[model samples]
Target chain A: MRRRASLVLLALAVFFAALSPLVRWYAFPRLAKIPPSQYQDMVLEAKNATLLDYTTMKSKKVPEVSIVQTLKGNVAAAGKVRERTGRDVVVWDTLSYVADDKGRMVSRIPERYVFDAHSQEPVHAGGEHVDGDPVRRRGIEYKWPFGTEKRDYEYFDFQTRTSAPIHYKGTRTVHGLETYYFEQTIPWTKVKVPKKLPLGATPETVEQLGLERWYTTKRMFWVEPVTGAPVDGQEIHEEEMRWTDKPGKKPLTAFAGHVRMRPDYQKATVDLVSSQRRLVLTLTTYLPWGSLALGGLLLVGSLTLEARTRTRGRPPGAGGPPVSSAAPGDPARARRPSPAPGGSGGMAPGAVGAFTGAFLKLLPGRRPPDQLTPAARVPSCARWVRPLRDPPAKGAWDSGRATRPAHPGSPPPRTTRDRR
Target chain B: MRALLAAAAGLAAALALVLAVTATGAPPGETSKKPLHTTVPAHP
Candidate 1:
């Protein structure tokens, strides 16, 4: 029996080990999906969104982000980063779409306009800044082709899968004020290697790595639940995963980053705390790995139980000899005499009846006093017997609290007399 | 008789181990229904 139990346990361990990968394959994908609508509107409001841009070394840890808001067919920016180098480093091109009186895009503008200074100047290539105009010289240029021809995206439909219901973690503050926070398990989309770069490296390698891991986005929204105002919010995407590029690298510990917005929704501050650039990827891999391991364990345990239930007259898990029928005088059957004179109610001569009559008292209902104090006759039996047969009633009483009234001086109370 | 006894003992042992691990390894909350406390940040 002991051998069989050990084998069963070993089999269970193996089954769980084998099922680990399978469980992960099913669970991680589901956990990774989240509703796209939650952030789609805000993302459109914060047009040309860039969480972090590590294009140049000067902005190594710092991020150059932009949030655009288009209104009355005119685009306006709150915090737009323009690299003010002496030369024209980068250019901004405006997209124009022809709209009817009903305010719907009918056709797109053919020629793209580049603004160096004035809107009248039809330049081939655009510059970082427009000359002549003071605001245009200091700021990036914004131009439109002609009347009823300007581009604007009303809403952004981000491609994302729907998953489990998000658990409302209640509200928290980004910079200040209350905001509704929600959390859900989700996995990252598989990141393909950059073909332009050498074999597996690219400028956006870190960002790609972070996107490949499984993580839960902690999203906070500060809205006038009544007025439906987009006041402030934050998002912290985190995961735990191992580095595929560097073997033996410790998994990224708590790959967490937070982006907070001002009440006006004009400004947002993103702070990323990462030991390595590929933190999110590392986190994503490990969480699913751990969850899968637990699932595997459960699977293995169930399989082992099923195996034991297979009764073929042979031991369930043991490779040893098949168990045979026991002989007539097995120790188990010999433990109790056939047709016991006590008839199950009485105790053996020298044996204490504490187990026989008094055992039932331990249960929750009524029990007789005689049965409760069964050891009362031990001293009388010892006196009647030849050798020091029965243990002294006093010693037995002292040993167990159940023996108190079983002694000679402390006689067992009469139940009939108490009833009268 | 011996086979039956051994099977009973094995089942008991397995049950005890499962109970021990479950009781010790459960998460931070008990089964009783208790109101959750939420911290609402003040308006800034």
Candidate 2:
């Protein structure tokens, strides 16, 4: 019964060991996939300096205004690979609309983003890559190697239809989970500005607002480690236009402030962290250790069962066959005479003793004698010399010291008796 | 039999403890529900 149980436990251990890697490779990727119809909201506070009075030459102080944007998106597997690129695709449709304090829509933008399904790189949306170059679409949540510092990434921007270099800044704890932080700065020289101005603005005003040549955007993202999901984000949009062409003149402020992640976004991040933690713990920690513990238990049980069976078969009050009388530390103690013919009683006792002795030798502070011969210490098939129980008569044929007749014609060797 | 049962029980207990610790510990989320606002440099 115990043997059967141990075998079962061993099988279970193997099953769990195999399951760990399966969960890591197959189950985790499926769970980490972005579900369709996910909704996110971002509340941005647009700050812009307004002229208090056109007549007055005083600097204007404009209070910050709040603009809430709701983002609704769905990701779907594409039916066929693109003809030009020959890559599998996934289509993402997102609609973002700005709302006022009362939640009334002010402006709506509908965007269709197509990405390579396997690589998750943006293939076509606002612009096409030249000659099948891999466009870096950092906005997608599928980028990997989240916690490493090996390479920087080029993040694509949907609004400007450009990509900016983003570098790993450091690690930070968000909502109890460790996250990788990244920052991207688009300098004023690289910022693309529209050629035309709005209705109320003149050329002088547009130039002074830095709407012509001076505008920059800085973005930061805190991404979850395992899933590569951005949990927290901040974006700062800055633009300055000067009234004079002189180099030393201070520029007028257009818009300056950060757009922080909303609560809904934070909740999404926390959910991703929770899911990732569960998967990682199961794959890397719990399953492996559980399998090891089960295996250890099985081994101990097997050893105990074998010992019990041997003890049960031994006759009562029959002390185990006499062991060697040599001192425990003596080198001769390692050698034991072979069992006599038809003597089955000594085999089990000898096996148990050998097992114990080998086990004890593995313990710390115990050393085997150096003088012990290899034949005595290790079981082998080769014949070894053993002291005879009684010496042969002076003239009897003695194999130990016997020699063949020299060249088949030599006289027999003389014995000690003959010499005496 | 007793040894085996004891070892199995201990392992089960350890596995339970691991599951409990991992499941109960909550991931950090945003502390405040209110929106945060910050000002950036106009000229940089």
Candidate 3:
């Protein structure tokens, strides 16, 4: 029985040990994918920002500018792309709407980003574009990949409509979660004018006016490494309307401010990312380490249990014919050190019994070791290990003498009452 | 038998933990109920 129990324990240990890496490497990679149904919205604010007054063709300072960013999962689009590309793809219909404090819309850009759910790498399938213009997407956008490394990653810039390397700045903690800080500096570059501009302005009209739009930004993000979620984000965004017809002309500030996630939105994002961090940690760190530790402990426990059972079967003088091998009246039988009247309560005897006894307590209606029959104490070892004397019909407890026969050198055997 | 039950309980607990971990990774739905780009009024 004990040998079987040890085998069971060993098996359990092996299962737990194997489950760790299986979940981390095999299952996590395949199954830990971004759901095609996930959608999220965030609000960011640029305080004391400057915006160009298109009617006056001049920069105007504003108390605040709000940018509401929404990302809606395009499940139908994702399904089509997945079929074509043979990859698990996700589509996010994203919109960044900028509005003044008075709720007057300044600008809004709509985009459809498609990428691999796990790697966050662009798949470049059909229906990829920014602001109704078909364009190939490259590099990470909106989010980093899971297990983000401390290295540079190519990040997409919507203004420049290109990919640039975002350098890993350093590590920092945001809302008590460790994160990797990354920054991207988009230098002054002539960018395409907005398709639709205020005051009846369009790209053609801006070109007719000999004015070109230039943009630069220093974007910073604090991203939680485990889930690749941003806890806090900021951007020093600056845009200008420059003169292409004239030389050394000062450009009109189109929009400029240090944009930051709204305080409440930042808190909300941190809280969400914190919870997700725990989930990722469970899969990558806690579960794997815990399984390994449990496996090691159970392995040791089973080995101890098996070894004790074996040692318990052999007598002090193992050289002698095994305990029950000698006949009842044989000199070898008479010399064996017989145990006292106390029984093991259907368990192994000695210190090992004390160890296993705690687990035995889980059984219902089990008698205490001291009250059980000597026959109950006799473990289910091989027959040769049983007492030299023949067992009584109903076990030793049913017989008047509860104790086994004493060795010739020992004192007489004691009954249960005498021991009491 | 009792030890086996205890071992079985441990295994069940471990399995439950793993299940919970995997379930947490399963994205449920839209995190925010706000309407999509439709909510934005035409750019003024």
Best by lDDT: 3
Native contact share for candidate 2 = 0.00
- Candidate 1 deviant stretches above 4 angstroms: A1-60, A63-162, A169-215, A227-230, A239-242, A245-247, A250-256, A263-420, B1-44
lDDT of 2 by residue, A1-420 (tens): 543453444344444544444444544333333332334444544444232222343345455434443333333233333445554444544444433233333233444556654345666543332112323355443243322343466776644556677788889988887878888887764333333223344445645654343567788887776656677777786655544357577755444556565555466657866786676566545665676665555544444443344334322322232222233233443355543221221222343335433433443433232223332222110111111223344545443453222222222443433322
Candidate 2: where are CA atoms >4 Å away? A44-90, A96-109, A115-151, A189-214, A239-254, A263-268, A279-285, A288-420, B1-44
The pairs that clash in candidate 3 are A324-A384
**RMSD to the native, candidate 2?**
13.6
> Docking quality tier of candidate 3?
incorrect
CA lDDT of every candidate? 0.29, 0.45, 0.72
Expressed as tens digits, the lDDT of each residue in A275-319 for candidate 1 is 221232232445446645653564344333322332222223222
DockQ of each: 0.03, 0.04, 0.19
User: Which stretches in model 3 have alpha-carbon errors above 4 Å?
Assistant: A319-420, B1-34, B37-44
Worst lDDT run of 10 residues, candidate 2 chain A, spans A379-388
Two-way lDDT contest, 2 vs 3, winner: 3
Specify the highest-DockQ model's number. 3
Order the candidates by TM-score, highest first — what do you get?
A: 3, 2, 1
In model 1 chain A, which range of ten residues has the least summed lDDT?
A73-82
In order, how many clashes per candidate?
A: 13, 4, 1
